[model samples]
Target: MTTLTIRRPDDWHVHFRDGAVLEAVLPHTSKDFGRAIVMPNLVPPVVTTADAEAYRRRILSALPDGHDFRPLMTLYLTETTDADDVEKGFRDGLISAVKLYPAGATTNSQSGVRDVARVYPVLERMAEIGLPLCVHGEVTDPDIDIFDREAVFIERVLAPVRQRFPALRIVMEHVTTKDGVDYVRSQAENTAATITVHHLIINRNAILAGGIRPHYYCLPVAKRESHRLALVEAATSGDARFFLGTDSAPHPTHLKEAACGCAGVFSSINAMACLAEVFEAAGAMDRLEGFTSLNGPAFYRMEPNTAEVTLVRRPEPVAYPATVPFDGGAITVFDPIFPIHWECVPAR
Candidate 1:
């Protein structure tokens, strides 16, 4: 129980911004995860096969020397997305999935789809090619309360899409509510979800309570403790439909501390340590591999990693860096506010 070796995990969701931010945070994830599904919501967004291929090159080029990391690229779904281009990227192995942002659902998502029906052609093609569509399941309606968006998204958006494309694979990215968990479970096939490390640990109080802590703020913001417990239970339950996706987004300290702060949690640096503690405390340490490493590949229909990484539980808490500095600014790391004893032994 003190030392666990499992196939290196893959992050089902991550945002590696271009240039300095990309260089700064890419290694934090690459060091621990064998691969990650790179989100395409950049300033301009990656909507074409050519954009994905170019972004892939930037990720590989920014990858630290000696670190073996594969960036599973995805296309940002827009109303005008070409089915031919999407299929071409999926067929050529350049794109692992397509992303649905739901127009203004989160950061850098103004270019997202305003009307779901406008993208039915692209969704139909994706289902035919067997490509998974990763969704940021939330509504952008100004009337909907922030806490209620995810649940409403299910009732109003995702359910309708499912009825239209039953066979299309879908991943509800960074799910934060009990409703989300129930919906993912309701689907018998072609559906799964990615749970973020922050959601399993923090709640709305983390942001609204004790003044306003911008660092803890994220879109589809963390819900109440009841929902947190639901996410914890779902993640620890060892379900194939549920797996790890850190959603390890990085934003500069200045932007995060501003009047209008950004929405993201940078947890890539110590995500494994956090997950190890969360799973261990739940008395489900044995199922860690299934949640972190095994189930993800099964859902993605790929082979688990051939390489192994060992996490050893030390006698005392390990201190992870508080901030990582890039060229223009520094990005803060997520603090789980719990003891972290697990450390990955460096590969030889």
Candidate 2:
């Protein structure tokens, strides 16, 4: 098809960091996505409703003029996270979900809960209140292979939680392996998964192939090709349980190009364009709306956007910058490794 239009989409996962970083990247997302489940793993992390509220204001302040984006804030779940505060945030509409980072699963996760049992009370309360727990879904044990963490997390941690609180809604964020997809399918009733544009497009080879391309690196890091195919199947299947969450995390280019690089893919700038190319490759263009716009709000128990966004395939490839400026510096944009012909905008 030359053109496609769907409800303005929401990103169930995103990280618009604080300060200058947040300001530089907020527009990339706000330009197209109607709303996003803003991640709370900043330096201090948003551990309370007040923190989320303050952060939300900062996000609003940074948004470009005429942009109608809403940041759906989240609390970084911790052993000390107050169940009452969590429930209050959910009820008051200040927070969309609570994130469990597994104490070193990803960036700024040192304060994450180390022991799942320590937060059983909080988990039980969330289940009771129907608040969804968005998990990073990777075990950070020193002995486990990096590639095996997500699978191990499913077997060791997530499975028990599922059994204990069958009613709790859970979203396995940026799922990178087939194991994750299978587990989510198994829970069919109250479980779902968010796939990233980076994961759907690249594999470990993109990072370590000809050389160590640090920009391609990310947490739960990209897995093998078979796993990528599995994610593609889940996303393009039009399954309600599978939806879009770009996980469009941005780390400064200096940090990413360092000896010990950070983990994230800054795709907010080109997410819809990349997703259009991905869905087109799968020959599941018809299901793109279900993955990007429809399923996420359904899982979040919110209404689909009243507005629509249109993406048109241009005759020539759309030109996108290699880097987006930030202060005097810049962060490299994600290279989709494919020609991008689609340009997304509000559907008039």
Candidate 3:
């Protein structure tokens, strides 16, 4: 089998938590990706231009020596987010997008926007400035069934937002179902979707197949197997509407193994390796470059990465737990959520 060498990929969505966790995980991400859109859901969320700039600097400081990774920063939208600040951040190149999280949607998201309508001014400013809105795309209503949240969000929140701000570009992050795929496909011009490596390879069954697997649990959670196939198809189809976003969220092991486990998967260490397996399984290895590297930059109106990275087809098992020495413990690096026979051997 032949190896594939392509331009360095950009992770359209990722979470590099602050401090030691950030230091430990940043290398895995920087080694493979040239740039990544860093999530804003830090302890208090990056809610201001100054906050984003400071956070970006911290990320740079945390990077291991000699690594040239860029962390594209974002603003966390809140009920009181000022539109002028949003515009200024974008204009000054301090922020690339604004992230909307319906409060309680994921980790450290209690400060997320309580009501989308309340943030219309911020959305309008983003639309006017041509800055895309990256959304978690799940509702926090306790009455909504957990599995149906994304579809409901599409019907209730997404549809109205699309109608209200027709010019606004939206990226539905880490989409989990066929409904999401169809939604983005229908509005391909103004809307795009990001697919995570785990969601593309496994499904809801993996979560319960061999008992409750805490590592498999994530926000928007995994959907049924059929949905998994749809995500795989959409990702490997060479459609610019779908791109790579590891959403490689990491939590301390105790937090994840507790009575109420946290919702996220730490997949940074194995993200590209898992993605390569998925593309190869679908017989679409040739299209992996576009999904992993090209489409995200195209959607964001940024230049594709110029540096090259290579991956070869070799069967080897990459050990989990690359060491999360924070919280006085280590967290397991999430696998593909499936057994993989093929491995990624990075070229020298």
lDDT by residue (tens digit), candidate 3, 1-348: 447888889998999988888887888899889999999999878999999999999999988887779999999989999889889889998888899999998999999988788999888878888999999989889999999999999999999999999999999999999999999999947799999988987788878886888888999899998899899999999999999999999888888888899998888877877887888889999999999999999999999998887876555555545446664577668866455444444446
Off by over 4 Å in 1: none
lDDT of 3: 0.87
Tens-digit lDDT string for candidate 1 (1-348): 898888888899999999999999999999989989999999899999999999999999999899988999999999999999999998998999999999988989999999999999999999998999999999989999988999999999999999999999999999999999999999976899999999999999988887999989988799999999999999999888999999999999999999989999999999998999899899998898999899999989999988888889999999899999999989999988777999876544
Give the runs in model 2 whose Cα sits over 4 Å from its true position: none
Tens digits of per-residue lDDT, candidate 2, 1-348, equal 999999999999999888988889999999999999999999899999999999999999998999988899999999998999999999998988999999988999999999999999999999998999999999999999999999999999999999988888999999999999999998865899999999999999999999999999999799999999999999999889999999998988999999999999999988999999999989999999999999999999999988899999998999998988888578889998888999898898
- Root mean square deviation (Cα) for candidate 3: 1.5
- How much is the lDDT of residue 78 in candidate 2? 94
Ranking by TM-score: 2, 1, 3
**Over 4 Å off, model 3:** 315-323, 337-348
The lDDT per prediction is 0.93, 0.93, 0.87
TM-scores for every predicted model: 0.99, 0.99, 0.96
Query: Which pairs, if any, clash in model 1?
Result: none
